[model samples]
Structures are given as structure tokens and as C-alpha cells.
Target: MRKEQRVKKNKEFQEIFKKGTSFANRQFVLYSLKQEEAQPFRIGISVSKKIGNAVCRNRIKRYIRQAFLELREDVQDNHDYLIIARKPAADMDFHEVKSSITHVLKRGKVLKKTSYGKNDRKK
Candidate 1:
């Protein structure tokens, strides 16, 4: 995650945990909250010690970062996003993590619906 997106404190995490909306799949839980300022979306990726040792946690964080790198375009506006890696996420390969993030984005309505909606079909 970028420097702006990283929620490096106990207080910010607490605020989001208390107020942000959350959704989860097998690999990750996504927490989101809106920001008043007009900046692009920001993100935080968390991998706890319960999930693994330092090396393992680093690997998982890397995968999460890669997923976010690919997904930034879709998610990079309007809200703040946090991705908490599950134990399963640490063990899985990159593909699984990517798919999980995509699912979370769709569930969170971060992915835009196509313009070709039912009304557009009439044209």
C-alpha cells in the first residue's frame, strides 16, 4: 500500500474497526469508510502475527500489495479501504489472493457496473 493508505496507528485501526463497513471471503476481509476530502481511495493491508512468522507475513503482504497494484484503478477513488489477510491468505498462492480481492471489491460495490444496463438495451 502507498504511504497515504497505510493506517499506521492503533487509533485509526480502531476507528475503522468501529465504524467501517466490512465484507469477507475465504482469504481476506475488506473494511471501508468514506473520507470527506476529495482524494483518491487509500488502502491498508494487514497481516497479523497469528497468521505466521515474520517471513511468512512478509510474503502475504507482498501478495496483497500485488493484488492492490493491479486493482488500484478500480478502487482508487472515493473511499478508504483496508484488507486484512486471513491465515488462509498467507498459505495460498498469489492467484487466490488476487481473486479474493476482486470478489471483495465486487461485494463492496467498488467495481463499477457496466453502462450497458437494462435501460441502455432499449437504444
Candidate 2:
């Protein structure tokens, strides 16, 4: 994600946490706040020290960012999203992280619905 697309300031994180509606699964928590004007969506990721050392924490954050990048076209614009990693997330691979994030976003209704044809089915 680009710097302009990331929510890096503490103030912005606080605002999103305060005003956003949250959704969660076992591995992650998602907070989403809709903006009044049309703008590109921005994302903030938080993984606490309690979860792991710097390397592990950074890995989780990277996974979350990659998930969002892949889901960008399906995610709603004009919103800010903050993702907080839970303990279980530290052990997950990239695909697992993406799946967990997708579940939370769907529950929050922030992900756009896409029609799947027979070919799109996994089996």
C-alpha cells in the first residue's frame, strides 16, 4: 500500500477506534469508519508487543497489509480500516491471515459481494 493510503498517525488511529464500528473473528479485529466524502480507503494495522517480538509482529502486519491489497477492489472506498492482530494471528501464514481478514470484513459488510460462477468454486 502507498503511504497516502495508510493511516499512520496516532490521532487517526484513535479517531477510528473511537468512532468506527468493529467486527471480529478469532484471529483479528477490524474497525471501520465511513467518511463523509468520497476518497480512497486507508488502512491502519496494529499488532501488540504482547503478541510477539519485532520480527513476528512485523510479519503479521505485513500479512494484514497484503490481504488488504488483494481485497482492495472488493472493499468499500470512503472508509478507514484498522486491523488489530490477535494472538492466534502470529502463527498464521499469509493465506490464513487473508482468510481471517476476509471473514471479518464480510461480517462488517465492508466487502462488496461478487457473483461466483461454477468455475469460481473451489471444488
lDDT of each: 0.78, 0.90
Q: Best-fitting candidate, measured by lDDT?
A: 2
Q: How many pairs in model 1 have backbone atoms within 3 A of each other, for residues 3 or more apart or on separate chains, i.e. clashes? A: 0
TM-score list, all predictions: 0.84, 0.93
Per-residue lDDT of 10-116 in model 1, one digit per residue for the tens?
Answer: 77777878889999888889999888889877777788899989999999888888877766666647677788988787778887777778888788877656511
Residue range 2-115, candidate 2, lDDT tens digits? 999999999999999999999999999999999999899999999999999999999999899998887888889999999999999989999888888888888999887671
Q: How accurate is candidate 1 locally (lDDT)?
A: 0.78
Which runs of model 2 end up more than 4 angstroms from their true locations?
115-123
Best by TM-score: 2
Q: List the residue pairs that clash in candidate 1.
A: none
